[model samples]
Target: MEFHYHRTGPSPDLATIEQAIAQLDPAVLVDADDFARVRISTVLDEYALLDCLWRAGVQVAMGELERQPSVCCGGCGG
Candidate 1:
């Protein structure tokens, strides 16, 4: 699973976001444009990661945390 985050105003520094991500350790920092996408394995991870971002003052857009299908290898049948 993946969580996408879009900030409303000036984006937080990369280090700030990186610190928040490290605390939860749920996902990998995938991509960043005006928004950020992270790949996580479980629903609980999603909640925890979001909480971490919020606590770190990320100011993520509400309802922007959409889940997308993860990349898969056919051999694993994920």
Candidate 2:
């Protein structure tokens, strides 16, 4: 899955975000722009990565990320 994040104004360290992405498994730092645009690919622990970005002073674009659809039937709970 792909994830996107951005920050207001400018961003300080792409290196820091890169480092965090490196340390976080199942996550890949796809691309980061100087204007504070970030793209990542991961199949696990997305929230953890988002938190990491938040701590790094970046804002996550939750709408850009794909959400898992509900497994329940259209008219049934199960």
Question: Top model by lDDT, which number?
Answer: 2
What TM-score, computed on C-alpha atoms, does each candidate reach?
0.61, 0.52
Worst ten in a row by lDDT for model 1:
35-44
How close to the true structure is residue 69 of candidate 2, measured as C-alpha lDDT? 41
lDDT measured at residue 19 in model 1 versus the true structure, 0 to 100 = 69
Q: Deviation in angstroms for 10 in model 1?
A: 1.1
What TM-score does candidate 2 get on C-alpha atoms?
A: 0.52
Q: Which lDDT value does model 1 have at 12? A: 63
Residues 1-78, model 1: lDDT tens digits: 566665556656666766667665644464467334433343335567677668777665547676667655678554
Off by over 4 Å in 2: 33-36, 59-78
User: Which digits, one per residue and each the tens of the lDDT, describe model 2 over residues 1-78?
Assistant: 556556466654766765666666534545767666566665446677777666666666555454444343558422
Residue 33, model 1: lDDT of 70
Model 1 lDDT at residue 34: 39
